[model samples]
Target: MKKENNLDKITRKEAISKMGKYAALTAIGTFVVLNPLKAAQSSTPPDDTGGNPFD
Candidate 1:
């Protein structure tokens, strides 16, 4: 079996901080990819969807 790295272990607080950073990064990535369309939409009034998305 291979040995684990003792040098790279993180504390619980560090892990939690890293989780928050990752979540924020993911949110920022999604927003960046979606921002162009959102900006355009915000510049215009929304059209009626016939009261239903399936309509």
Candidate 2:
């Protein structure tokens, strides 16, 4: 059996803080990359083909 060490353990608060930081960074990165594309795409109207409902 292996021995457990206190140094290897992480508290709940620390884990939550780390996760929050990662989530925030991911959100910011996604927004930075996609925001411009979204704005550009939004300017164009979507195709509204009133085609046959049952094709």
lDDT of each residue in 1-55, candidate 1, tens digit only: 9999988999999999999999999999999999998898889677876676775
Q: What TM-score goes with each of the models?
A: 0.53, 0.65
- Residue runs of model 1 more than 4 Å from their true location after superposition: 1-5, 40-55
Candidate maximizing TM-score: 2
Candidate 2 CA-lDDT value: 0.94
Misplaced by over 4 Å in model 2 are: 43-55
Q: Tell me how far the alpha carbon of residue 47 in candidate 1 is from the true structure, in angstroms, after superposition.
A: 17
TM-score of candidate 2 relative to the true fold: 0.65
What tens-digit string does per-residue lDDT give for candidate 2 at 1-55? 9888999789999999999999999999999999999999889776878897689
Residue 29's lDDT within candidate 1 is 96
